[model samples]
Target: MQESISVCHNQYILKPQSIESEELENATFHAKQRAIEARQTISPWKKSHSLYETGGWKSLFENINQPLNLSTQSKEFQTRYNESANSLEQVVESAKLPLCPSGQPEIGNTVVFGVVGGTVEAPSIAYLTESQPVTEEILALSDSVKPTEIFRIASSCQADACRHFDGANCRLAVRIVQQLPTVVETLPACQIRSSCRWWQQEGKAACYRCPQMVTDNGYSSKILQEVGDPYSK
Candidate 1:
């Protein structure tokens, strides 16, 4: 016989009433703790850069105040150093933080909105980036047209204004996990997962229902209505 312990979505089996099993459980628990600590140690800012370049606050200071060799210090050298420092600062400032698509838009970088289609067997959608600009006519019509009717608006996450935010974790995400039916067991191939607030917060559980989520008015599905409206009491 074996005993099992659940860890979030995963379960680990242990031999029944055995000292080895107890030690194993303890080791497993400690390993998970160490993994969490390691993850937290790595700053979220580092993930923004594709090249893994150090563009954090500390690096910014170092770039600005690096000691210059007097013998090699020329007018051209100073100008180049200033330019390099400016470029580094811009990179740090411009790094786009992950946002919740269902939340509010913070930046006007690009709208990655899309419509969820296909069947339960297979869902289909496309992310609309800056390259594919929505025409002025469409933009004008969007005011009258409901977003869910046409496309799911994948905007920036406003963690501050969100009702689910309890000064720390997102309660809405937890609610979504409880209320919504899991459509898929595995995580969907999402372009915005790297910078998605839901994925970051709720992990793969969020992705299970993310594809079918609609934020338009007059949703027929009760589950959709509740999950879509974060402010709904």
Candidate 2:
């Protein structure tokens, strides 16, 4: 099984070992911080998902006219948001991809589609019906354990910016569909299936095998650990 990429609590693990000098290490750290800040400023996931979680297309265009907080701060907000998000399960949504091996780009925009449960020796994933946006507060509930070990998160596809993505396609998604075996006979309920890159590229086969996908599966089955390799292809 391939070793999981090393990470420092909720931080992006971008080729950390290559820096041989203190000056170079400082430069790399600063560059990463800048890149993260820039991404947060410009990433469409933040702007788009904010509108999406509030309602849908209606809220998107309508919220521009009304105050932004109206959708999120009012009564029936949670109910309406969940209903709106789940309704997309029927209609095909825009493409979103899996959380990267390094780490999630922005947890504020990341959605929890599946829950990793069972034990370390025998981990299993259960898909969720409603989209659940992750918050910093929610992640704190896990304490010492990595949240990726307990959740299958989906976020906006980073394309060339992600290591698993080749110039044209997502190699990790491809590897998953090709190397991972189907664990479920029936199509599992998914919060992001309509927008999932795996589902869009691999179709029902991805969903069939999705129950076994663990993002930070250091303790997962040997087969899963192998499939999790970002550079396998």
Best by TM-score: 2
**Tens-digit lDDT track of model 2 for 161-184:** 445567667676677788775555
Q: How accurate is candidate 2 locally (lDDT)?
A: 0.46
Report how far residue 170 has shifted in candidate 2, in Å.
1.1
Error in Å for residue 146 of model 2: 1.5
**Model 1, span 121-170: residue lDDT tens:** 12223333321222333333333333233344454443333455665666
Q: By how many angstroms RMSD does model 2 differ from the true structure?
A: 15.5
Query: lDDT winner among the candidates?
Result: 2
Cα lDDT, all candidates: 0.40, 0.46
